[model samples]
Target chain A: MISLTDFLIVSAVLFCIGLYMIVSKHNAIQILIGIELMLNAAILNLVAFGKYDRFNNGGQMFALFAIVLAAATTAVALAIILNVYKQYKTIDPGKIDKLKD
Target chain B: MNLAQMLFYVMSFIALASAVFVAATKNLVRSIFMFFITLFALAGLYVLALADFVAVTQIVIYVGGILVLILFAFMLSGRETLNAMALQQKQFISIGKLPAFLLAALFLIVLLNMIIKVDANNLEWVKKSIESKNDIPVNAAMTEDIGVGLMTRYLLPFEAISILLMLALVGAAHLSRKGRGA
Candidate 1:
């Protein structure tokens, strides 16, 4: 049988990778992808822990809700990214320095 | 190792590797592809974990809905791939580079250490996990359990999420719409 440690380790690796992307990548879309990775890591944790709670299944329910929320968030975020690209003519977050005093 | 353990490791490696590539790759379109790989691998992991509903949902919603929408946004943005990859490796090789790597490494080490140091068998839940009674159901219906729970216990959150999704759609339409105002 697969252990919860396996799941946790995977999530940890994914979360760190997502953090690296968020910190290193300048592209707005890449940053959004990083955010999704981080969110998926958390959702993975929820489902992993929920493996034991069959009577309640709260964790699985939370994961379901999280997946829905993630989709909604990505839609709004991508739309904002598109608007940024429209205004700045570039999707590089480093170059879009309008608010950076 | 058993077949389930083997499958878990394989899927996890695929998910982690592709996730790293999604962040590391310079080609934006390639990153999207890598992201797809990562999500698909994660879905596989979810299945191995016996989260069948969540696994299928991840594939349908993430790979189908969000990914298509993301591709559409990229197309609408009208960025040529050549110009997109024009941003050099300077940012990656800069002063903040090594520290970021060290930080991520440290975090991974800390988390792994914590997980290893803790005795899983001692936990209240882990004790029961051995019985396999409360574990994922092979015969039980997830649809009924989840549906009934959502209606009776999680109804408020369900309704709230519907409202949230509606608001998000409206906001996305407004934000992406052209020539509204400054």
Candidate 2:
């Protein structure tokens, strides 16, 4: 009998790990990976809650949209990272301090 | 526990572990591999959650499309030394060690408390709704219902998302082609 608490706890752990990764990693691509992880955690929670949504399947549908959006975001982000790499030789985000406010 | 519960636990563990590895690994290609594993596990979890449509979307869009794009970007980008383990100064101790852990713990506690409260109130409503429902032949009915819903209630949003996607494509092309002279 896996409880909802179990699912939520797992999601929370994943989100925290992702946040830590995004904060600590110096590479732009690594930060992108962390963002993906965070999105996955949210999707997992949506699907888990969808189990209780038998009527409209709202959670399931939301998760579908989320998956698509994530893919789209990742594609755009990666492309931007490539451009960043072109402007700066290194992918280390710390080194690309040319656009500082 | 039943087969479904066991499968859920196994898939959840795999997804969480792979996600952690995706964040932790320094090698870009290795991180991509971990990302695939994480996506696959999430797809499995979606199936387990009875979101067949979402599961397929996850597999096709995330695993099939985005991951391939990520790998392509990695290969096309001229940065070869990115896979090297580049550690920041006081990597474990500076900025992330205590604050992240504390924030995570506090968030977990607050979220759990809110969930417990909400579930207590909503559980009976959900259970009652499920109990009253006679099982429809879902396989055929679900697709039709979803199609109708998309066309009727969600039509505006659906069309809007398509437009957004198109805009994104154009924007990406424009951004990338800036200094390349078409």
TM-score per prediction, in order, is 0.91, 0.84
What DockQ does each listed candidate score? 0.68, 0.48
lDDT per residue for candidate 2 within B11-74, as digits (tens), equals 9899888877876665667888888998898888767766677788888888889888878877
Provide the TM-score of the second chain in candidate 1.
0.86
Q: What is the TM-score of chain B in candidate 2?
A: 0.80
Best by TM-score: 1
lDDT of model 2, residue A27: 70
Among these predictions, the greatest DockQ belongs to: 1
* TM-score, cand. 2: 0.84
Clashing pairs in 2: none
lDDT of 1 by residue, B69-136 (tens): 98888876565533654654434446466666778889889988987887443677767764868777
**Interface RMSD, candidate 2?**
3.2
Question: Model 1: clashing residue pairs?
Answer: none
Q: State the lDDT of candidate 2 residue by residue for A18-92, as single tens digits.
A: 887776777777788778778988998887777665556666667767776787687678778877766665666
In model 1, which regions exceed 4 Å deviation? B80-85, B88-95, B128-132
